[model samples]
Target: MSENITLTVNGEPREVEQGTTGTDLFGGDKAVLVMRIDGELRDLFREIPDGASVEPVTAQDPEGLAVLRHSAAHVLAQAVQQINPSAKLGIGPPVTDGFYYDFDVAEAFTPDDLKKLEKAMQRIVNEGQTFNRRVITDAEGLEELAHEPYKCELIGLKGNAANAAEGAEAEVGGGELTIYDNVRRDGTVAWGDLCRGPHVPSTKVLGNAFKLMRSAAAYWRGSEKNPQLQRIYGTAWPTKDELKAYLERLAEAEKRDHRKLGAELDLFSFPENIGPGLPVFHPKGGIIKREMEDYVRRRHIEEGFSYVGTPHIAKEDLFYTSGHLPYYADGMFPPLDVDGQNYRLKAMNCPMHNEIFRSRGRSYRELPLRFFEFGTVYRDEKSGVLSGLTRVRMITQDDSHSYVTPEQAPGEIKHLLDFILGLLRDFGMNDFYLELSTRDVDGDKKDKFIGTDEQWDIATKVLSDVALESGLELVPDPGGAAFYGPKISVQARDAIGRTWQMSTIQYDFNQPARFGLEYQAADGSRQQPVMVHSAKFGSIERFLGVLVEHYAGAFPAWLAPVQVLAVPVAEEYYDYLQDVAMKLREAGVRVEVDMSDDRFPKKIRNASKSKAPFILIAGEEDRDNGAVSFRFRDGSQKNGVPVADAIAEITRVITERQNTDPTAG
Candidate 1:
């Protein structure tokens, strides 16, 4: 030993022998899954440097969970290759809350195959194989991973990776290329993968807390043009309890899946002829959509927005003037030739709004002009990425644009941010945080962004300051901005704690200039106006989808397609129930009488299934007393309320926008 060296272990100075590994420093704490050496995560078995500040990463911490999941991914790959020797490796990267590995196999994996793989993985975990890191040159890596064409490709991109998608970072990003080998206690190599890793010390750290999820077909690197492969998804946690909890959450999420609930509630449908990503709202769904539109439109009028209408398609030259032609051509539908001119289905409303601003204007008094529209735009979303209404081809944006002088940019951004937050709150999505998405100034993506360097700097800082001043949590999303400008997005958490990007406020200095949008300034000078783009609901279709899941289809009374279901206890009480429903209708409650031949209990069950907020039942006693019984969504009831009083109470709830069953308390 070359003498002892001083190191700071959890803020306490300690002397350890030179070249002592982090595992030795934290030998007493088995729960310390990994160690952070000088603010950088490193393998516990890696040696610590002199004067290095080391901190233990417990199994419950985020970084520790990532390590556990990634190590579990490696074990999964090993199990797959062990079961099928010919299966070539692709990429196995950790994702949000889980990890998945892609493999090129002759046939897709079956459920039985996954079961076998899980058992094999557990065995490997119990064996406690050591994960050994080895630095290798490109030539050496290429030679070692010759069978893995995908890995070889990643090796070629060692320092210059073009992956914007998740999971690709595990292969290439930083300085050097390295391979991690799974070494058995007997000095025999069990398995390995080419990775830039800081994994847990051994397979034993994975424990029995991992379960192999289902497998699916995935393109090699998320590119449609790339080779397709079979991908196995798996989830790992620090303890079996956490794994059980995650599984329970997954079960709940599956039950709340909008597609399933949409069919059950008759809210929406995707017909075979309508094409994928195109959904047709049923009458019930249309009611919800219309209510949303009406509320947003009222808010726009109150907020001083000039409601404008634009055609669905525009001349191709219009997009070119707004910089969408060549840069955004991939995301836009191919142009239609009309009279020797090209016309495109608009992918965004901002370009058209710019055209409206430039149509005819010349006064400083109209400097901060705001335009609003429920503009339906079309986008060529990749087939693989399309899901229900959330990722549809035809999106209806509650889009608005504000054209202001350069000096008023900050104030206008703040105003839009406040409007977006209030709108989300009104829709019952109260839990929110702000995300500032700015240009990727330091990366290869700079060329993809428009506007001068000075303009980008000013726009980013202004948005950031406005976001920070809102007193909400601000998360930075570099490289997530649109090509034209930086943006602030509202991220709202739903009922089950899943975050959704609900609204966005983008600041643009390029498009106005590009479109030659000008307004006279206070000094009597023509100035290129700054543009602020905002979509309170992002898209009506998407927000409806989110709410369907958020509320589990039990919309509040005001938003529910049918607010009240009136049921008669007996045939003789039909007239009484109908009278009560008529009174409710007069009170602006959406009431429907169950005049069907079904029994009273079945009628109640139908109301429950429909998720109507209120159920009014009139029986012989109620008819004699001129009273109605109330049944709420949660199967609770309050009987013997006067019919007039019942109508007043129900209307009051709806008018007050209470997002709960009447008897929820």
Candidate 2:
């Protein structure tokens, strides 16, 4: 008689044969791609331990999707090798929405090459080869993967995979080395690769939902010091429909790309003479920027924040005092020698803010001291990562710092959170979720973060509690916190359901102590104050980029650079429209009249292309009636409105900050 073992399967107690595997427990469910045993994902074919907690991981789950993509990457690598036998493997890892496998080949892959590889990969997927995992020693891994120098090097760094490379953790980690072999029905190994994985049972799980994206040159292990390799990117989905949906989203995102809109609208430009990652806003762009700054500055003043300013560069020792020099040194520009001392461009404004706080004495009555600034800071971002305004070297931050007693930290954080949410809503971003970023206490880089266990726990709990109280969906981001403290970041989704990290409220317990900042408590004893850092718009440049994409360049009337453009229906109506434009300009509207030799229709087309929120048209009927036709975005028109009513309606939309098309109703 076969013995049976008791197990908790998906939160239910069950009995199965002692040697039962995940494949046996979940074989009937085609949606289940893998199994989670004691919180770790495992292959379905792996045997389950007695009394172990087992849960089915479906392809719809995030982890299972990653496993599916990783398996597809292996198949992709196999297809590459089959075509180009001389190609050597680097590393293949699942990234956001897809997977990429790097190869050391003689030639870069072309579009035709990708199509050929897709066909080859489809054949492998049809073969339904089983993914068989095998454990091996370091010596065996080195010997078996000798032809792949990159793999051999990764094997050599098995235990310290975190320090090895960006994606090396997907290949080898602090455990016994393993290799996954693609086994055919004849019990013959078709291909294999060194990886630490929990893959799906077979290539069939990938289905026909995978596609080869494109190929690019990437440095081995993500370092310029290493050899460059041809990296092929691909994406996989659970079903064909999901893949199609993802492709559609990609198309939509491409249409809404901010860089393309910024150039087409002549809003901003990254001139080569000004250097990469530095954007110079055109006059039109400057107007929008000014409006945003003016609104945010007024809101800050109303929220009890004192406006302040700080220099662009400061002594390097000041960063060391704030614990940014040694920890965040890489993000800062190289130090400049000034007056026999090292002066560095500020990558952050908190250190200087701390100096301002320490420059005075405080009492508990003024516990929540808030200081705000529109500080422009510089960072040494790599050229590879720079993407127009989204990722730039020069960033204008609406940075603020609040110093409070330990007991007052929670309330102050909540206040900031409310402020941030309201500010985002004012800009038409209503969808939001909060992220609680905490320290990674168990990670190898724990030493990089400085704080006592008790301090970190207290700070994290305060932020977590306040974020939960806000009633927004909270997501946890482990290892994403600043070196000094934990943070609550507001993640706002744009019009297309894409999330962006817009604002942040960080609970800092270390900076106060590092700077020796203190306040007199109610008991008349000196107590260390907790410092909170908040950025309503993380950076003006990045926020503007996001806004451009969110609105697709058709900004609301309040934010539009050219709020109203008056175009005459004929050359004779030019004087009437010019008069209307002058009236609008007097009413504090950014209005312009088209008085050029272009045709009336051409002028209207130009106004539409400029993305003006409201267009005023005057003709013979309007000239006699003392009215104008109000044309808006969306090709809708409201005709024959009195000039006074037209002006009132336009000014009302702008004053109310209406984000929708004014004439949509």
Candidate 3:
């Protein structure tokens, strides 16, 4: 029986028969399809359920393909258990690029073993086996899994994984649990796993558009304390072309990796001896950071922020007053004892900035007193999760705080939104989206919050309204708010379609009240002032890291460590090239002359490898002509241009922030 149901297909309304699967909407074309009901992903066979909204998705939408890949993971898990009966099933979940499944096995699964598993998965998908879901009483499940120790452990957890087990952790807490059993056409159950599923209907939905990527050891549940499990990684698509594209994108991203570029370009380093997560900025690295920080400093001053400095190690009382010690102590470096008093490397700038406000008796005129600082902080991160500059222990945050009267808070917030976004754009980043996070009102730790309900309601509204009225698209992130306040976060999308959080403006009431901060009002009443903590470059170190990945280390001439490098054809031309460097320096450009005894071609290659935006080649004839030949990083050259003309063009490009040389060959 067909009933009338309407759906918005790719932004246009279309009528369809009831009970129509998402695959039916695609008309059997086998394109990667993302489907959602009322803006949320629903499996293809998701019931129409009486006029529910549905939207078809394409492989172009990354999430759509992820759902397809996640479904493929279940197929792989079922195939593995089918081939190796003793291989205990674990958890497999979709990740950023694809999915990985963990298993408790007696021996490592080699590359050869992965090929065998891939073949088995292919056979299952080719067979068109259906995935069936079963829900049973918790007690019944305990009996069914009694023989499987790992499943027994999960059953004991009620599925709250405490110890990391195969593919997941085993903890105790939560709701009734369920298992998904993959069944053959004959209704025989071939394999099953404890799971929370929204899987595609059958293995055929995975098609032949998937491949096993790699095999690695994963802690049973991503916890270091848990038993290790062999995890097989894989990617899947609704079509072959999409799968191929995804693999190519993965390769491109790898090639543009910041760690690799940093070493090759001689920009930064993190020596193992210097310690994990503590990055060292080389001379070139220092230049990049200096430019970034100097730019930020100018913006802060222009925005009416008064610069301030604070000691890196502060008395533990500071954090205790800020209420960070007992609750957030885990993420911070351990405290150090100093002069019979305990101290700690600052993990936050709010506490110190609070003391600065208390330095004088503030007045209503100074109600919105803004203090700014570039404070370095430290944290002790878990070793297993550490990665390049992305997840570092030491970072210098470009932080600021504005104390404002309740009535002035809104304007302050609006100014912050515009200013932060503007600064990010100037750094050659244009794509931006915002997320406004607020407190978990229904959480158990609700009492951990400090502000009165009225203050909370006002602050949250001001932030949300500012984000909305600023003409920027913003999404509300429930329960994503800081423990002490609500926040607005701005993220920039990189060239490879990845997003990075670059700026944040959080409205905090907890810190002000915790430190007993207040100002004398117009009526002579000592009233608590609200605090707006914001950072355009969340951390200078982290911002540089994001910019590195954004431009793939090919920074614009304005921000490049060495914007111009001169290659002298002979030692006799060195004096002329050195003069050229001086000219560029006088023109406010970072330039260098290659004076080493290396060959000219070798010097040019070294400059290009360092991502220099322009290369100046000085030869005898060119030097004699009071000119120099120019080569650009983007493969263009200008022959025998006068030194004055070259300087004028290069300086114009640098001043205008033009990434490509227009006058080059």
Candidate 4:
């Protein structure tokens, strides 16, 4: 039990303590580029076990790749300090798809400066400087960091963080603090950063597969009160091919940015005078919104859901009964005095729905009541956090609350999950993932939740069992649940690999008790019904924004605001084409006849740019022949199809709501 450790790394023998660091012996040498300890990632400063075999982690391993990127960020920070010595460094963490470092600089960095910084980063990596760790006392740490204001701030923050770790009532805790020193071979310090040590052995391990992305102004600690810091973004990967692919995808994602596409397509806008985070959808965008809602309503009705409507605002007493005052009141729009009493623009539709259920005493036969509503709610999202239609203050949720008995909750939950899967499929989202969010066991690590242990256990089990039985790959997210309940979040992957959460099925035992909702069972006793709150497309506006990005503004036939554009080859064919357009309009196709005096090609180009799924080219010859030239957006052309056949085909595509096949690309 007390033996020292001896391990072999890359065929080299090294003797160390019971906890031997993989980075210490093999980390300094040139044999291993990356390291792995006990099958998990440990920074070079981590201690290892006695007689345990240590293997070198390489760039090929997925876990090791982030360290490479983190090291690249350090090199980039060094380059920034070289140019601007006063630039104070902040923490840089490895993020998905890339890494970013914050800097308090004298001036903003431009595109030209990014190029120079990238060049300097390459030079540092080429130098192959050694990375070592240094241990110092708390007082010594403050002295070493005296020159850097931000570093001093970080040291101050550490004290606060440690106090938090101890608990609300402070208890004594002890641990040694350390820093990483990036020293050169000639005994000159290249760079020294106060970080928990875990880095590549030397700068040579980094490759040229890195890029410096755009610079953005970010507030310190995400709070506007702190000074604005310039953050330089960058991406790194193990291979040149992966890096190139990432850059290409980034370019494509930018092209499909929903805010940009919203204006270009005349879909939606936000007025500055209307205050921030509130979107006003134009008439054109309203068409798509209504279509999406109608689709959901029809499906829910078929699944035995009863449509319901509620008021936009409610009395403050209603919220108190539903227990929204302390936990969720912050996100709500401010209360206003109505007739000497307070009222709030409802932030969640569930409370109102609860009032409806309580108005009537329910029998056991009335169990599993599903109520559906497209309720609009208001929130007070600060201006700086708002972005396009994705983050809006005034939005509507496709919200539904289902009340089911404890015994029937599992089956009802499964049915709802299956229903959501079908709806997503219809909307062209096939790839999905599920996350089961639960309360953290170690609440002392942070703020523990306030629910009773028995309530927490029951709610967690309910959602967890449903998620397992649904046959979805379940990922447990610690400390991610709503304050009152646990939820199973349904996320979808877009055309790109990024995942977004679009639906959530939450179980709330607390809310039912808060409102004292009950049903008379067959035994003639009142019992609490387990409440299930579910939303398929979480919000209409947010879902539409996601659709815009997923389809890249190329909506399918059924959802296109203007599905068909009938362009006459010349003015000569206008009357005949106008007649044809009316027939198609009667057939329920969104058709518009081109009346502009512009040339036919220009009109066709405009229609294509509008992203209409169908373009009917009606010329004099085709009008006489009772035929039409059909052109598709994807560069496919069909010549001289009978007008009737073209109409039938277009209707079929619209009625079926076909999506692009993944195999096609």
Q: Assess every candidate by TM-score.
A: 0.95, 0.97, 0.89, 0.92
Q: Rank the candidates by lDDT, best first.
A: 2, 1, 4, 3
What is the C-alpha local distance difference test score of each model? Answer: 0.88, 0.93, 0.80, 0.80
List model 1 lDDT by residue over 1-665, tens digit each: 38999999899999989999978878778888789989988888899998999999987788888878888999999999999999988878888888999999999999999999999999999998998989989999999889888888888776666653357678665677889999999989998888878888788878888998899998877878988999999999988898999899899888889999999999999998979888999999999999999999999999999999999999998899899878899999999999999999999998888877888966779867999999999999988889998899999999999988888899998999888888888888889999999889888787889878899899999999999999999999999899999999999999898999999999988898888888887798888888999999999999999999999888988899998888888889888888788888888788888889998788888878988888888888899899999887767789999988988888888999876554342
Off by over 4 Å in 3: 1-67, 159-177, 185-188, 443-448, 659-665
Top model number, TM-score: 2
What digit string (tens of lDDT, one per residue) describes model 3 on residues 393-485? 997999999999888889998898889888877887788899998877776556656667887787899999988897778988877777788
Model 1 spans with C-alpha error above 4 angstroms: 6-15, 50-55, 59-61, 147-149, 163-168, 172-175, 223-226, 663-665
| Window of ten residues with lowest summed lDDT in model 3 | 164-173
Give per-residue CA lDDT, model 2, range 535-559, as digits (tens).
9999999999999999999999999
Off by over 4 Å in 2: none
- Per-model root-mean-square deviation over C-alphas: 2.2, 1.7, 4.1, 4.0
Tens-digit lDDT track for model 4 on 267-378? 9988889878888888778889999999999999999899999999999888887777766788888899988999999988999889888998998799799999999988
Candidate 3 lDDT: 0.80
Q: Comparing candidate 3 with candidate 4, which one achieves the higher TM-score? A: 4
Task: Rank the models by TM-score, top first.
Answer: 2, 1, 4, 3
Index of the highest-lDDT prediction: 2
